[model samples]
Target chain A: MIQFRPIYVICLREFKKFFREKSRLLGTLARPVLWLFVVGNGMNSLIRPQVGFSYLQFIFPGMIGMTILFSSIFSSISIVWDREFGFMKEMLVAPISRVSIVIGKAISGTFISVAQAVIIMVLIPFLGIHLTVLQFIEVVLVSILVSFCITSLGILIAARLTSFDGFNIIMNFLVMPMLFLSGAMYPVTSLPTALRYLTHVNPLTYGIDAFKHVLLRNSAPPLGPEFPLAVDLLVVTILAFIMIILAALSFRQKE
Target chain B: MSIISVNNLTKKFKTLTAVDGVSFSVNEGEVFGFLGPNGAGKTTTINILCTLHLPTGGEASIAGYDCVKRPDEVRSSIGLIFQDTTLDTGLTAYENLKFHAYLYNLDRKLTEKRIDEMLSVVELTNRKHDLIKNFSGGMKRRLEIARGLLHYPRVLFLDEPTLGLDPQTRNTIWDFITTLRKQEKITVFMTTHYMEEAENCDRIAIMDHGKIIALDTPENLKRLVHGDTIHLVTEDNEKACAEIAKTFDILCHAENGGLFIETEKGEEFIPRLIHSLSIQVKSVNLRKPTLNDVFLKLTGRTIRDDVLSDDKEVTREFVRSHRRAQR
Candidate 1:
């Protein structure tokens, strides 16, 4: 049987460690601020959006997506660290089901990512983007769902990794490609046909689309959600379940 | 009754048979030790018994639960302190034990009581709030011991519990272990190549080449060797060696600038041999046979050969796991 106490304690350990490392909090926070101000503002004067919103406001949700993507994936690297430092064996030998470990890690990653996503929302007023109360609630809901989805995907990959030697490869090959192809920095429709197929397959694409559905509600067709709100939520929710289950399965086979 | 029983258990990697048809049983309250050099499969056998690795052949059980089939049940009933430090350095000592208690599903009240009890047992009660990174190597090990017993498991498995500690700290750790064994009623099953450390075990199984070569109490295993060992350093080493062999009819070998001989009573023999020798006897040292001598008698090698082979084995394991991660 899946034990809830193990899951709770596992998540608690991650939470305590995350807060204890002040540098880690600063590092995750600094990335999005740099992207939103330098990258977004610098590119704003060049590529003018067809819509009434400025490029800074246009990619706001994309910036939140970027924050979630990096932090969630970064959080999963704890598994590799645990393996290297011998703490993974501690949890592996525990009586709890392996599923509890995976779920605990996924939930912690979700909370940490969602927390960073909320911190990025503080930049909303400065970017001149106004949202109604209902829109803000919807945005938080989507952030939670999207964070859970991406973190589960992170856990899925981290579950199979035995060392940090593969970490750079994962960052270069997996994280970078997912960010570029997810329409996080630009519109998916503007991409070539071949790359557009990749965006449709990328789980983060739906997550960002869901973000846009709430954040950029009044925007034009191409700049708005590519698919319907229902489609985005359904895809992310389904992929979240699949990734978590697969992560737990892979974790059980960890030898 | 035997708390742990193994019947022809074996584990095979692709290129190596780490544990080969090993069988042994550990009594409920004894300190059972596996004495072996590096790469001898002591850790492999412990891993299998702890439910971390599946045995390729044979049956093993703890507390009447099969290791492979009822792993969850087996795991919950045992405590394990690995060869390397497994304590999380980022958390405080109290936090680490609390986390372990939760993982083992200890009740809230029982967790508080046990955490406090174990911390004091290891003498870390004062350092409970401090982060583990600041603690010494000995403290970390002691805390890990405390965490392992938070659930009060029946069998406490310590894989090389004192592999690289100073003599003083090792003694302190051993003291805590001995006291805790009685207080908590635990059956300790540990593995160590340190002969003196193995002397602490009520019974020891000398493992070499993935098989138990000798299994008995410390005194009994020492008796397997001939007798007391005598080391003689004389003014004329070559002549003394010849004279001792020819006159006494006892074979002696020269090693490290000293002539060594094993006899039933080295103290009595040394006085007679020193007077009979033509050359001046510089010094004579006689001591009881140690576990190292027992290992030498069995394997034709000393356990101190832990340097080159151990480094190579570690690198080989790293390369193998690196390749697996690459896939």
Candidate 2:
């Protein structure tokens, strides 16, 4: 049977590490705040009327996705750091199954990612986005799911990397494209047929779509064709599951 | 019973055979040391027994659990202190121990007690709350040792536990380990390239080129050295060398303007040589057999020479710079 104590201990340590580093905490929040105010407002005049909502409001969910995506993926960089510093040997030599380490990392990343997203969620009122308590709860639930999926993806990538430099190069290359394709900065409906097809394939697209669906429920008419909430949740859940298994498999390889 | 047993265990990484059909068993409560220079498969053997790497051939078991087949049981039974410092520098010393306790499935009260006891054993109780990043190398090593023992495994594997420490710090660490052996009766299986360090082990297996070149107690291994070495700087090397060879019936070589001889009871032979030799000897130095002598006898080279030949320039440079910085 899988033990719960190790997983709990690992998750608690990660949480402690994340909070103890004041600079890292600020860094996680800074990017999203910049995008929300500077990028969102800068483009507001040009894209607001076309999307039927203020650009800041339109991009809020995408900002949440961005926060979750960057923070979660960057958190996996710790695994590479651990390996370099010999701390990975301590964890690997432990009696607990490798799966526990992966699960613990995924859970911790999800927690931190959610925590960062909450920082964005607090600015919901300033963005003029209206949401009832139920809608807020729905957004949180979707945020947790997206965080898990992205964190698992991070773990999978990190398991195969031996150096932080390599992880940074690969993660940056992948993360920017992933964020852009996910329709976080723009509406998927306005994309050309080719880019729309790409968005359909991007898993983060579903995450942002799910968030937009819930956060914008009481706003003006739906900005895009409403992909059923059930479909979005199913896709994310499946992606998270697959990424977790892949992460575990990659971790199982001989060190 | 042997706490660790291996039957022709071999580990090959692709084309290179790291451990070439090595076999040995470490009995319970015994301090068994694996001594070798770099690239001699000492770490490979330790890794296989620790279940970190699977052997390509043969079999091994730790505390009656097969290392490959029942890795979890083996891992649970063995505590590993890696050559490199593995403590999480971001965490406090207490937090590091707590994490290990939880991993080993220790209960709340037991975990607390063990953490406290281990911290005290390593004499880090006062600094338990301090982050490891602020710790010195010796302090981090002590914390790692405390963390390793918190689980209280049946066997403790220390891979070059004192690799980079100073002589004083290394002695303190060894004191803690020897004390632990007597107090807890845990078998210690360690690897080191330091000949003096290996002298502390109950028995040692000397490895070279991925093979066991010799295995015996330090005293017994020293006995394997044919005789004591004598270096004599005489008034005339040619005459002294000829007289010593004829008089002692032992071969002597003129090296670096000195006569070198290997003879039994070199001290006794020294007086006779002085009495018989016509020319006066300037200086006579008689040295007893050391582990380096034993290694030389077996491999025709010293461990340092072998280490220098190994192409681990990065590690060599790191150790050099680290030592220089420390000085």
Candidate 3:
């Protein structure tokens, strides 16, 4: 069995690394904050809600969801840099289980990505949406799980990339497209019929829905119609497990 | 038992064998140098020893842990300075050391005390608070060395630590390395292509074509190669140099600017060499042969150029795939 030292060490190192890039920290924090502030207000002009809620109220959960999605996907870019820099070589040679390193990345990536998500999460009420303490905590836990899943997926992609150019190309081709197609920007059903499958395949879809139900819907989740809560949870959970395994397997390449 | 034992360890990339059945061992606290020309697989072997690459065949164990099966233990037992600069340019040097100290499980107070001492050792104590991005190449290299030593590993593997450094900085680094050896009992295994560098080691292994061609102390290896070396410089190009070599038993041969040959009694042989070649030599020297002569004798080739031609080379092709990694 893996012990606590590896996990603790990896996680601590990962957390420190996130703060290393001042521009990255700013970009990460500012992206979600702007979405919650200006964009949340700007969209109120064009968007009309059918439910008895303002546009800000309707868009709040999606913004929180967007924060989690972007931050989680970008977490792997640092890994790409680390690989090119040879820090990955140093990490691989450390006296720890390669599997725990992924868990540690998840810990670090999730901590920052979720921190970004929570920044937006806190700003929701300032833009006129309200939530109770229990509901807020529930949304935060879902953010943590979803962030973990997304971050591990990023690491998986990073392992195969050889250079910053390759990593940038992947970010543009894969992450950007995936984030745009997910339920973070609009309700899942609002996507064109042709794009429904895209959202269905996106783990971000269920994550967004879970937050929306707890934050905006403030009611029983529409399990069958809006989204299958159980299936989304299952997909995220499974992907997290697979990605962690793949990250461990990919780590030997550094050796 | 050997502190490090690598036997028949090999790694292949498709059809190219990077390390071919190479085997060697280092006793406790010895300054072992791995010397080779570029692309000669010195880095490949060190990577294997540090548990950074899995051998395609055979096995390597460091401090009694199997490299393939017990990589973690190998990691803990050894420290590595990679061929590429792996320092985080974003963080201050202090932060970088602290971060690594955590990975090595050094406590906060102890880590703080040691980081301070290491900074002074590298002569970067005042600069420790500055971001590594702004540091010069030599300073960066020194900081990297300090970082590698933080955990106080049993064996420290330095992969061309003085590469691209100015002579003064290289001297400083050399001094620091010797000081480290004297003060700390850490075994330092360094790789270099420079013959002068091999002379600094307690023992040296010279590799070519993925195998060690020669392994011994510099003085001992030089003893294997007899006679003094002569650098024959002439205005006339290849013809006269070729004629001179044909006229004598040239022990060492090089074709850079002129003929560099080694033979017994270089002083006595020079007059005959000039008379036979029908050329008056511009200069002649009867100097003792260095380790470079030993390498030339063993490999039957002089490493004058990095490659015969820069274009259409295997090494260039390999490095091209990682082009964006330069950033």
Candidate 4:
């Protein structure tokens, strides 16, 4: 019962708004620059290249993960806005299936997140990291998968949230934990058993690990991909599927 | 023929029943209204018919499709303007309408034509390019009406369409609604607690406590209460009530610091009562019975009493400000 036209229009509306609010694009882009230059450099001086990679190069994939994670999750905040402004009823009363709305939002969030991830790749030359054209393409593909996975999780959370009050809770409890435990800033192998279990559960762990597979191919064993590339993609794809189904089911509530 | 049919429809929210065995029908090309005070289940009934809520009992249908069994068909056959504005304030008016057209899956070639036609119907073509946040309340309402009709639905459901607008804007919206009924050949099923607004309907169903107390044409409902209503204020309302009952044999009820009585030939009766009563009469007002009087007569209390309480007024103001802050 899912219709293509509704999904297309929904995504198109999001795309139009994304460009209209120029501040949003600027704001999402600003975080990566600050992290890459300010934090990465300060950490670079403090931590030596004990594993054959500078701190700046080691956290490069983590920076991309940061960009995608923030952009994708914040994009789903539109659902809360729509509900507050009463526009969500318009879609609910329409002749389209709820699945279409969920997919439309997920697709829009993924594209926007991936766009920012690509923009982050501009730092590769500055970081003195070499990337083949195929490697760059593989990185973009992983970004898309990771973005969709995080955005779907966001949709599932937003589906039940009635206002922005829950947004702060999500930021503190969900987004921050997912980033810190995902091995984006540090290696998961060095973590103790308790936090390492959380890293395994976080989807971004597999995503950033996939990035390390391509970007850090020549790095020492401790700094390279934590799991096989196939395992990373498989986990992300499965999580994305489950999150989207749960989000759509939440929208189907008869309230 | 009837386009909307409901039979013994009921909806319960845990312990309280919001819609209790309500039944009504709306004919094609007719303006049918549900009039009642707040918490009277008018909104709950509309939500069920719009396929937004499931009825706990009985059945309802729009355009031959069951609301519960075939919600997609019911949704496709009807357009809804909710009690609150649903426009995306970030987008232009034209973009909002375009979003609606896409949601309804209108024909690609006809979409532009329909959007333009609906905009002009609401006289919003000039403001189509403006962002909705910049538009006034009345403008936002007109755009919502336009977007609702872009899909060419068989029936249009409006839940308290003119709730917060000023009198002038309310009138203008009503003009567009009536004109669209003819121009689009569409059925209108609207709910309102405004008795004055109920006059605009071809048929009005007075609801209270989740039940339809009375259903008929406005004129016929008014006819249910015989004669004009006379409001008299005197030095002693208690004495006036007794005097009027003893002398004129018409029982007068003291309400809102006045004595209200129902009698034929109110103009002549007012003068005779003033002369006959020993008490001094400060003022005497007489007017024809309105939908309010009809409701008062049927329900034993005025709808105004339920709707015009002090707490309700404060809550309404708070809600209005809250909505403004949200925008």
Backbone clash count, each prediction separately: 0, 0, 2, 0
In order, what is each prediction's RMSD in angstroms?
A: 2.3, 4.4, 3.6, 3.0
Q: Pick by lDDT: which candidate is best?
A: 4
Interface RMSD of each: 2.8, 7.8, 4.6, 5.2
Chain B, TM-score, each prediction?
Answer: 0.91, 0.89, 0.89, 0.94
| Worst lDDT 10-window in candidate 1 chain B | B318-327
Which of the CAPRI classes, incorrect, acceptable, medium or high, describes model 1? medium
What are the DockQ scores of the candidates, in order? 0.62, 0.44, 0.41, 0.54
CAPRI-style quality class for the chain A–B interface of candidate 3: acceptable
**Candidate 2 C-alpha lDDT tens digits along A109-147:** 999998898888888878877778997788788989999
* Residues A1-255 of candidate 3: C-alpha lDDT, one tens digit per residue: 354666776666666666666787788678767765688678777776445666666656666777777788778667776777767666666766666677777778888888777766656557666678898888888888888888888887776766777766876877777767765655556667878888777777777777766766634322212655676677778877887778767754442
Name the candidate, 2 or 3, with the larger lDDT value: 2
By summed lDDT, the worst window of 10 consecutive residues in model 4 chain B runs over B318-327
**How much lDDT does candidate 2 score?**
0.85
Q: Which CAPRI quality tier does the interface of model 2 achieve? A: acceptable
Residue-level lDDT tens digits of model 2 in B21-75: 9999989999999998887888878888887777889999999999998999998
lDDT of 3 at A239: 76
Give stretches of model 1 more than 4 Å off: B233-243, B253-258, B275-284, B308-327
The candidates, ranked best first by lDDT, are 4, 1, 2, 3
Q: For candidate 1, what TM-score does chain B get against the true chain B?
A: 0.91
